[model samples]
Target: MPHPASAAPTSRFPAWLLICGSLMAIAPLSIDMYLPSFPTLAGDLGVDIGQVQLTLGAFLVGLALGQAFYGPFSDRFGRKPPLYVGLCLYVLAAMGCALARNVESLMLWRFLQALGGCAGMVMARAVIRDRLEAHESARAFSSLMLVMGVAPILAPIIGGAVLTVSGWRAIFWVLSGAGLLILLLVHLRMEESLDRRHAAPLRLGTVARSYAELLRDREFLGYSLSAGFGSAGMFAYISGSPFVLIELHGIAPSHYGFVFGANALGLITMSQLNARLVRGRSLDQVLGATLLAALAAGMVLAVAALAGMAVLPVLLGGFFVFIGALGCVSPNASALALAHQGHRAGTASALMGTLQFSLGTLGGAAVSVWRDGSALPLGVVMAACGAGAVLMRHYGRSGARARPGAR
Candidate 1:
């Protein structure tokens, strides 16, 4: 089992973990880079809070749709074509976002930009699988998570600083620069990982049938949904947390990045910690523990909010715990879902990416619906997603226990 980022055919641990990790970081970089600028964009563009929120939703829609194209195309062609194409598109899209004069324009460009970004995000996972084994994929995922962790931690801090000097538009410029760096890095370090020796000539009919088979696989569906809904909880928080923290609680807009980054700290720290636990226990065994912990954290937030105990520390600690638990839970769940789908890994990865981002959009929508200028609304959304994931994992594991396993 070779690490996908590893260039050598027989090498399991790629020497360029830093490089592969950075390529994977592009999507998160596109996202967290602008979070600190959300409020500023609303004011500069003369848009309502809801309209500004569409920027986030648009990125997600693009990300969802972008994967459908990149996945099969990558499967048919090779990895680098999509990577190069997507990075170029991301730069163009980021520039468009920088130039947007109105909410509608920003939303459209943001979605279109995600169309490029979704390629980087989805292919990173496929590449890791292309290079590694079940447990090794989890390890590579941890590396990827660590890289993603830096974007959330550093992007907003950079955004906040840039805002003081140049305003929100500067953030897009920075994203464009980041995308350019990724483009160069991929050329220098990444080699093609996919072997199309047995790959079917990728066609519309075959691709449709491939997707159909994936949709009907109960075990794959179970694990994918379990990881996906769990991730939706975090996206709900991402969509609404800034509003709750800055506007409602009176935390300064400049400080929102730190609060957001604090949650990433929780997620990053736990994900790396979970990596250490993988050798001693199976991924499922570890997820059973972590998802329950997240469920408990969400429940506490819900109960505490009901008791009029909705305070800053409670909000911070609860999210820190829930998202941290998700860091451990999600990568493992995704790894498990694709574990046995070795032949159609590209198609399988696409559907999981599709479902994951789809849930993310729906979760963002849920936040908008209950968005009543308070932490309680967001807390309830998180609680429901966390509880839903727990239920899915519970029954999904049992259902598989009684059946023949994946080929």
Candidate 2:
């Protein structure tokens, strides 16, 4: 195995793949690992499900705000120190989460936890940019997704077992330990990908200007939104699936993890294959294929739902294919969008990820509101987001033409 550090920068990759994967996995690990524990939390904290769910929104808000700072700080200072500080904070906040006596306290701690976690999550992409060229970045990102993908596949099972054996608090103990381990790996072995070439005193003003520029630029927004909405499509499925399956189709809550893992498997499978698909095609061409495929798959699901095809296997199987296309669409579209934002990659990545997650949270919320023990609402939501992705792509090319500098 090539070392993630000290690997020669050839077109061929070395072991930095592990670093990329580990970094990207941080948030998914945090989220997925805690999901199965939500019920326990609600019961223990003497709160309703909605109260417990707010913890998710709290964490998401912190992630967005913290990402805004992390990218600029990393650009200004260096990659390693910010992460070290952030991870330390993460451990503390996670411990706080474990100890909280009420819903309000848990929400506050979860927010802090996300703030700290965003350091690793955002910078992972920046570090990837630091080490690789554009095409290489896309490939490396896909490889990283492969690493992060394991969280959804395994977190629930582990959380379930922990819940059965110990209690919800045990979940935080696991997280705290994981954070400590990551902290060690990073300090002992992870080298600073932020090089001397970065402009001195990477000022907040400069970062602000970068965000300003990205906002004014339509191509960046369009491509970014395509990826963002594609993510929202998956979120729609996630929020609606449990109800649609459990209440409507009678799947057990205990088996929800397996159902969830099946979808993630589709995502992982597609992401792993993305590099091969793009080998000879232009990035846009590959992205177009993925988007069209998503649109097509979603149309199938919509039809199935409208036609009273209420079978659980078919509903999930269709979404399995749909989310798989999304896995391909999201990374490739994001890679293409950020291709030229070298000086402001952190800001760009933060903006993209923030909007992606925000849209995700919104889509999930929509499912909860519109839910009625049927698959139609979820199918409609997925189809709507899929269509939005297509429109975003349509606008992205035009925007690219208008803004000559958008890379």
Candidate 3:
């Protein structure tokens, strides 16, 4: 195992950390970059806006399912092998997306793209767990949020520029190139982090039983659900924002990237702050506080929408607050969820990703199905997710307190 001191808070940020963050960034890059082109994509494909949104949902589904397999594969073989396979597949699928002719084909390619890209997400978490304890892992995750946050801030701007210059097809070409570049980086720089002696078997029944046991773990469930619902709220924003800003509020597609970047900036700032906050307080304490703040933001958003006050400033403010809270919530919740699962870190990480993306898929689908040319549905769904996260956190704390020798 690598020295734990290498991940120490005072140590300089490392190259391997950057590689892990880049790996985990595939999702945000794939999701956010195409957002600015939604209207154009709909027009070019000769489909309605909703059909274009289906591609996003399909990608989320792929992320949810793909992580499950990647986790075990990483554990059974080694981290680098699954990453090599996944990135290769990602490059090919991205090329497929670039060449897609219709909405149906686009959705199919996006799903395949996600299947290939999510290996990074699963393995990055497992790798971090393999190298650090709970507290250090939280700090590392916060650092990762800093890195991943840049994707949302830049992807749309890059996408909008590509859309303006070449066309929507060019966006997928950019993604393909990115996947290829990352694949090369992984091959050259990423050392295998999994200790071979501790590798879990890739047996079907064993994997199922492992996942079932994790589900039965109250602390794990709490952190997972809290993180999942918090993420679901963000996915709700991602699904709803393009229409709410560009179509309803008359923000030009070309200029939409700036508005999206502002929200992402907020998220990034809060995540960095969370890194400091955890130094003074426990992860649970910080997570609980942030979850409450998220709940408040969501309720405010819902109230504003219901009051027919879905103006630009109101919506943006609500989204900034709600999404920003996730920066703190995610790192803390993820660290807590996998804190005790070092023996099966890959499986734990995969299950957590699966739940998070599954909830996110539902959140995106809800926004699509409940699209009434208004922001009410988005507000309600986000608010509901926020409430659920808070409740789950409370339940988890209660359960922890009830146990005789709980962590």
Candidate 4:
């Protein structure tokens, strides 16, 4: 209908949307795709399930550290180069993961893979900031969520199928292939989203100042922490779900996949709903309402667990509502935070992601340490994160109102 060359920005929107969504999908794929392989991987590597699970922690650690590194680098160089390098590293690390001889080696390779994969996560947000105003960016993020959401929904199914026929090693090989294909798409279709004039030089002092500026902005920290703490509950759910569903409730692995997909669908549905709601509403107002909703859901969850009423059905309903709240919180927070940080979008995006992953790691670790083969620990951690988000949002808004000549 439109000339292809002129269509790059809008008319051929689906092409770029797919690319950006794929970029965001990289981290989720890396995390969820190998989950079904945990048992087989432990057996093959001569380690127990707990040891195999450490690879997840290692990957998350890498994701936190690597996002911090690439955000500044992307700000200095153009977005495209950092992404290219990160994807290349991802491919290499995935190959190493496939060839690993032991749990320790696999952990190292997984960390490297995460380090590389996080570039996509950070840059995807930055690219959205680069192209759109705050409100538009929120909608773009929800659309991206729709595309990226499919990865978590399908990755386990795909991984389970591969593990069924070709074994766990084949799973790594498949990830490697996916990385290579994404790299090719980037080279062929994606243009530089960051304008050269806005590029800051990569110096230690400059980088420190950039981050320092972000930390000093009260609104930015509020939105970032609100989003981070809101999303942390889902990470706790992910870390605890396998045990709760499969081991405790005795759901079969095949059926667990379906249950997992169902919860993820809740998340996806809420995110798109957020996109629609925001069209006629302010991001701040929508965020406030969603944070409160998530808090209520978390309260119900914790009360159920504390009272020993955490049957599988109850737990599933709580997860559906809680994660759906995050779908609203995340896009709004990112858009609001970056609204004022347009000049330093990469650094802001990076810091936001770093906080999110760090908080998630804390929630996940709490489940491991406090796990008593009951749902209490998971429920408590989830509730805490939600409460923290609500408090942050309240403080942020109050502080904004107190500022002289504030909008």
Candidate 5:
């Protein structure tokens, strides 16, 4: 089917938003939902906590690699076909995770699950680019962030409850059910979003040229890198928080879910506030301001870590602001990056996801390497990511220059 007009039909906007938001939520849901189960999962698999952590890193790697293929494939085919295939793979992988007896098998299945599930994240951004203008897309992304926030807010809580009733393996069973539900929703409600006239070829040379073209756009690179590093900080927190809060700080497992959910709620609240604040303001202005806030929060977090200060309150408050700052940065940076790449929205979005997840994997790994069962690794890594984002936007001269032939 040919793509619809630039904006989807008014009557369909709610459904469109729901579908895109839910799809985008898939990754966070998968990641956060099982987090509360980590201790129990490790015990059941007869592995150390560090080995369990590796599974998360492996999932990030799979997500990073998978987007490279799915983005270009979606551009060649249509959105719905690749989405269907990905969701099917997700269901199978999730079920495999539920059945796995060892950490090795569990890690492999989780990686495969990410490979299947990340199609939603890549395509959700591409769909936003395909359907909206730059500023409008930023606003839409904020709304999608609000919707996506529900998953993280509820996921750990739900995972905890399920673990209480059953076991860690049941978490994967629940995720498989989620995949099935999403597949049915796509089949019933989602129309093809890719326009036939803009279809990219499937050849390797064409794919290389497309990414090469995007790389040459300094404006795109600045925004993409800033967003990528900001995401790295968030992933660092994701990788380290369970150990820091529960294992080291002595927070109970059930309460850990609430603490995690509270941070997610803060992020959701900030995204909505950002959507309103950016109205009539330039997205660049919003992005610059938020990066500064993130940088300052990072500094405070680092000091608290290094000085051996009030650990829990410092982490909670610092991250409340730090992650909230991301609420502003991510959508605006994404909008700015893809503003000039309408014809290759999928490729551009794919590259953006690749950068974010690849950097995120590294940040998470760094935390593991420096793990001392304290909040120091989490604080230091997150601080570095925030500082890195600020530097990229400042020295990178965001939006000051563009590629010669850029849109």
Candidate 6:
């Protein structure tokens, strides 16, 4: 079938992109916004920084698992219902997080909060797929990165301010309020984009088979893995940056947001550049170039750390390049992955998200486990994951050529 018309007019920033972007922003806001509070959380909960990092891991785990459920549910029930359910759960769970009095309870609440927040992540992509062709989807996803990028740039800064004035717990209260606002916007402005004719069944065996089929598709695996590992590098940074910057480097907790936001600004800039580049170039071309850039940056970062040259300037430079490259990498990879999977967009999106966050969880966990009061662990993880992304893309292309009939 011919691809549906573009989701919204391309001439100007549309309302639909805004809404979808906000939905996608949920994860970033939830993850980045509270990062400045790691030290405070550790002190308040009577735990060390590593334990506080575990809470982040818990959230990533929830995000990964929750997407699996929401993907199928959105596919079967139409997008809006699962979003309603998820957002409500997110609101409640945010409150739970705010009220948690111990590290264990905070971890559990963070997990639940992620479970609720991830609906927006999966469904936003599916909704975009529901309305646009692959190339248009590429541009749209880039636009989304532009929209969603604001959250990370602002979240940490806002979070730090809240932490200073109201305390660490108040950060979650802010999150709770953000969740409510998004929920209201969804109810008032968003429309269900899933066409019933394309809806999949909610059967157990069918879902398993669908996911298995996705796993076996080499092209899908390539795009998914490349995006997953590239993104995993970012998660590694997020997991380790608090301790590395504040404790080891002697940066103030409040100033950490500026550093984080600077990298995020790089991300936003590169994503928009990708958007313009794709208008003339193939998605694969842009993806290939960015993946190489990421690998190079990752290596530079790893080398700097190993050489004991991981000063603030060196670390920020490496991170900006690596993370900025992801601006081009993720949107292109995602558009390519979902290019041929429109019939089951929700399922495809879910599987892609699962891979991304599952690797992300591992990245975060690896940092926490390797916490040695040095930046070496974070650097190594970023470099390794970036290499993984490049290899996956290369093999994915080779496999696609070898099995011309795979899709």
| Residue 85 of model 1, lDDT score | 92
Give the TM-score (vs. native) of candidate 3: 0.97
Query: Which digits, one per residue and each the tens of the lDDT, describe model 1 over residues 1-407?
Result: 22343333344335455666776677667777777777888889887777787788888888777787888887878777888899899999999999988999999889978988778877777777777677877877876688778988887788888988999888898888888888898888877777767455688999999888887776677778888888788888888887878887888877888888888888899889888999899888898899898888888888887788989889888989998998888788888878777677767888888888888888887886776666777888788888888787766676466557632
Score residue 245 of candidate 3 by CA lDDT.
90
Which scores better on lDDT, 3 or 4?
Answer: 3
Lowest lDDT 10-residue stretch of candidate 1: 1-10
Q: What lDDT, from 0 to 1, does candidate 1 have?
A: 0.80
- Per-candidate TM equals 0.94, 0.90, 0.97, 0.94, 0.96, 0.97
Better of 1 and 4 by lDDT: 4
Those runs of model 1 whose alpha carbons end farther than 4 Å from true positions after fitting are: 1-16, 402-407
The lDDT values for all models are: 0.80, 0.76, 0.91, 0.84, 0.86, 0.91
Please identify model 2 stretches exceeding 4 Å from their true place: 1-13, 200-204, 300-308, 402-407
In model 2, which range of ten residues has the least summed lDDT?
A: 1-10
- Writing each residue's lDDT as its tens digit, candidate 5 over 295-325 gives 8888888888889884788888988888889
lDDT score for residue 183 of model 2: 86
* List of clashing residue pairs for candidate 5: none
For candidate 1, what is the TM-score? 0.94
- Model 3: per-residue Cα lDDT over 298-390, one tens digit each: 998899999999888989899999989999999999999898888888999999999999999999999988988899999999999999999
Model 2 C-alpha lDDT per residue in residues 159-224, reported as the tens digit of each score: 777777889888888988888988888877777776656544666676677888887777778888
Name model 3 segments beyond 4 Å from true.
Answer: 1-10, 402-404
CA-only RMSD, every prediction? 2.5, 3.3, 1.5, 3.1, 1.9, 1.9
For model 3 the local lDDT of residue 22 reads 95
- What does the lDDT come to for candidate 2? 0.76
Candidate 6 lDDT over 279-354, as tens digits, reads 9998889999999999998899899989999898888889999999999999999998888888889999999999
